[model samples]
Target: MYDYLVVGSGLFGAVFAHEAMQAGKTVLVLERRDHVGGNVYCETKDGIHIHKYGAHIFHTSYEDIWNYVNQFVKFNNFINSPVAYYQGHLYNLPFNMNTFRELWDIVTPAQAEAIIAVQRRSITGTPKNLEEQAISLVGTDIYMKLIKGYTEKQWGRSCSELPAFIIKRLPVRYTFDNNYFNDRYQGIPIGGYNKLIEALLAGVEVRTGVDYLKERALYRNVAKTIVYTGSIDEYFDYKLGQLEYRGLHFETERLEEVNHQGVAVVNYTERDVPYTRIIEHKHFESGTQPVTYITREYPAEWKRGEEAYYPVNSEQNQRLYQQYAILGRQEQNVIFGGRLAEYKYYDMDDVIKSALECVHKRL
Candidate 1:
């Protein structure tokens, strides 16, 4: 019997399986998708690596995590500076001094702070919903133009209806810097995430296009321990109600000219606009190809059997997940990890760190 049967070929499972193999254990990885990289999988077209799912920028403040990922594949210095388009105006992301200057024709940090403070006065006492919370943090102008429409489209719900804690803190930078993440280390894999995944799964056996849940009987007895990275609720057969998630629909188009959009990511923060953002795949790698590929991302309501993107961390869903967590603890030899299995959103670095910890603790 294999020592571990990794049920997903995502980062978590790949790392765990790799470590297990390094420690001289037999591990088998199974991926439901046709490819092994999970959502990080890229479909290359005309020398441009298209982020099939969406734009995934890896950023982390941990030094060890940065060093650990670098072991597999080389990463390029691609900083994420996403731009937001609102009402025919372009603004730098993260509500920085540049954004303030563009919005209110202000140059100094003091001017920006003064304007934001005055606008924030519109909300007083305890904020009830996401709208008030955002306004209280970054003022009405930034919230209205940059935050409101994009957030609404992302969650598929009006900001007013969402919980206040959803936007507990909106970082307002005083510098002209447009770097989106505050993390020290940030970049994408030089050749795309597939290289990283392939390197991780190098010495391990993997089976693609294999649904473990459906063919449980054939593989259940093959491994001594099961490392499940699928949805936790689904593991228990959803006996304790299904959790909610926001889904994304991507439409990728190839154009003849190079550089369709100036940057890698552009947020279309207009309520009337159906899509949330447009990603220029070529810009992710600074490709100088004769043609460019862009993907327009549209957020949608996630239903059962559909790909779950971001988990809805509402109180009701958290309660349901807790019930499933209890059942998960009782599983004989199954270990749950990764975003889907844990019912939480995880960045690439966080997920890799989690998998390493899982290996150290469990293996």
Candidate 2:
């Protein structure tokens, strides 16, 4: 009998299993997907490593978390600087001074400040919705051009319908810097996330393409404790109803030319565009070769059996998730974790930090 049974071999499951095993416990990891690494999974074709789910750039300010990830594979200096496109106009993201100049043709910081002041004065009082919140933070021009359409498309709802809390503050920089994340450590694994996961689960027993729910009784009877990283709703058979999530559909292609898009990620902010963004794989690797691959990311509705990418996190969804959490707490030997189990969206760094904290407390 194993000491721990980790369901879902994602980052949470893998990290927890590794930690438990190091504590002299026998661990068995079961993943519903055929492969490991969860959403961070990458596929290679013609010497190009493509981010199968989406472009995942690892960035963290936590030194311990950074050091923990480095134990598996060397990371490259791949800082994320995503560009925003709106109405055939391109601008540097994160609302930097360069983006301001590109938007208004203003040369001096004083002029940029004056323009934003006027825009901010036009809107007054606490923002009731996302539209007003964005306007208050970044001004009307930037909001209308960059934030409005893109956010609307992403959430599949109007900005007015979305809560103002969703966008508490829009990051605006007076400097010319356009580095997306302000974190101290940021990069992609030298090989791929799959390799990193493999290193983490080196000594642990792993079985992929095995649904834990199907063999629930058999696995549970053998293990002393269950570390589940699958959806909490699924674990309880959706007894409290389903938690909502926004799904994504990817259309990937391999091309003969060395490059497609100049950058790793390009955001299509225009509302008319069906997909949110397109990712060029080789750019993430800084690869120089004769072939390249790209993937178009389209948003989709999350159904019961489909892969749920991002939790909706609306008022209603959060309320429903609270019910699931209550039921989860009652599960004596089961621990819910990761983005899916908790019904929340998490960046790579956040997940790593969470797993580290969980290991410290649980193990």
Candidate 3:
């Protein structure tokens, strides 16, 4: 029997397995999918490395997590500066001077500051909803063009329905910076995340196309402890109601030309657009090939059987997750983790930091 049976070969599983092995423990990693690296998996087609899942840009403020991931793969300097397109008008994201200039032709920081100050002063009381929050922070023009429709479509709810707390603050910068994440380090791995996972679990025994739940009894009997990174609610057969998540559907295609879009990601913030964003795969790699690939990302409602993406952390869902969490605590041998397991939406950096913390506490 192995010391640990790590289920799901995502970042959480892979990192924990690697660390456990390093601590002189025998670990077995089982992945439900045919491939490893979980959602961060990439494949080369027509000389283009396509992100099979979504575009995962690694950005983290935590230095320990940054240094830890750097051990496996060399990262490229791919700063994520996503462009927002609303009704044929493009603006640099993160509400910077460039965005303000594009939005209102305000050239100076003082002009932008005066505009925002007036807008903030116009809103009298405390903001109650997302619409009020946006108006209070960045004014009507930027809110309407950039945030309103996109956010409404993202959550599939009216701005009035969404709580103001959802957007605590809309970061408005006086400078001309457009980098989305306020992280010290940000980039994609040189070879891709798949290679990084492969390097991380070099010596560990990994079996792809192996569903832990399907072989639950046998696997549990074979391992001394279980490190599960699947849905915690599923582990208990949804005794507590299943937590909700907003799923995404990606439609990918390869083109004959070397370039598709100038940038890696271009978000369509208008309500008219069905898809949220278009990702040009080659831009991530700085590729100079005859053919390039692109993907259209469409947000969808998460079903029971489908893969969960963004957690629907509404009041009801939070309560449901808490109930499942209570059940998780009772299981001494099982370790529930990752976005799916915990029923929480986490960026790549957050997942790494979380995995590190999990490993530290468990072993």
Candidate 4:
């Protein structure tokens, strides 16, 4: 029997399996999808790594996490500076000085702050919903132009209908910086995320297109322990209730030109525009290929039996997840990790860190 039966070949499973193997443990990884890497999976077209799920720019402040990933695959110096397209005007993201300058034609930070202060006076007391919360944070102009449409389209609900906590804080910068994250390290894998996944699962046995949930009886007794990285609710057969999730639909196109939008990512902030952002894949790697590829990403409402993306952290879903957590804690020889398993959103580096911690505890 194997020492560990990893139920998913994603980052968490791969890392755990790799670490367990290093500690002299036998591991078998099973993936439901035809390929591994989970959401970080990339499809290659003309030497350009097309993000199969969405634009996943790995950014982290932890030095150890950064170093751990670099051991498997080298990373590029790609920084996320996504531009926002509203009506006919384009502005920098993260509501920085460059964005304020583009909006009110003011170069100084004081002038920008003054403008935001004046606009923010429209809201008083505690903000009720997402609209008021956003306006309170970044003022009316930025909220209306940048935040409102993009956010409404993302959740498929009006900002006024959403909770105020949905947008706890809008990133407001006094500098002319457009770097989205404040992390010490940020980049994409030099040869795409597949290289990292391959390196992690190098000598470990892995089987793709195997639904462990369906064939639970076949593998349940095959190993001494199981590392589950899929949905927590689904693992219990949804006996409690279904956890809500916001799905994403990607429509990728291969263009004959060298460049399309002149940048890696551009957010279309008009409510009239259906898609949230268009990602130019080549720019993520600074490819010198003859052809380019782009993808229009649309936020979708998730249903059962569909691919789940972001977990909806609504009040009800959280309560239901707690019930599943209780059940998970009672299950022996089973350990849950990663986004879906925890019913929480996790960055790439955070997930890797979690996997390492899990292995440390196990081994």
TM-score of 3: 0.96
TM-score of 2: 0.97
Off by over 4 Å in 1: none
lDDT of 3 by residue, 307-363 (tens): 777787687888899989988989978888898888888888898788889988877
Task: Give lDDT tens digits, candidate 2, residues 155-182.
Answer: 8999999999899787888899889999
Assess each prediction's global lDDT (C-alpha) against the native. 0.93, 0.88, 0.87, 0.93
Identify the candidate with maximal lDDT.
Answer: 4
Instruction: Name the candidate, 2 or 3, with the larger lDDT value.
Output: 2
Segments in model 2 whose C-alpha atoms lie over 4 Å from true places: none
- Residue pairs in collision within model 1: none
The worst-scoring run of ten residues by lDDT in candidate 3 lies at 115-124
Error of 3 at 215 (Å): 2.8
Tell me how candidate 2 scores on lDDT: 0.88
Provide backbone clash counts, one per model.
Answer: 0, 0, 0, 0
Candidate 4 accuracy as lDDT: 0.93
Q: Please, what are the lDDT tens digits per residue for candidate 4 over residues 1-363?
A: 999999988889999999999999999999999999899999998999999999999999999999999999999999999999999899998789999889998989999999999999999999999999999988999999998999999999999998898789878999989999999999999989999999999999999999999999898999999999999999999999899999999999989998898899999999999999999999999998989999999999999888899888677788899999999999999999999999988998899999999999989
User: lDDT rank, highest first?
Assistant: 4, 1, 2, 3
Question: Which candidate, 3 or 4, would have the higher lDDT against the true structure?
Answer: 4
Q: Write the per-residue lDDT of candidate 1 for residues 15-121, one digit (tens) a residue.
A: 99999999999999999999998899999999999999999999999999999999998889999999999989999987899999999998899999999999999
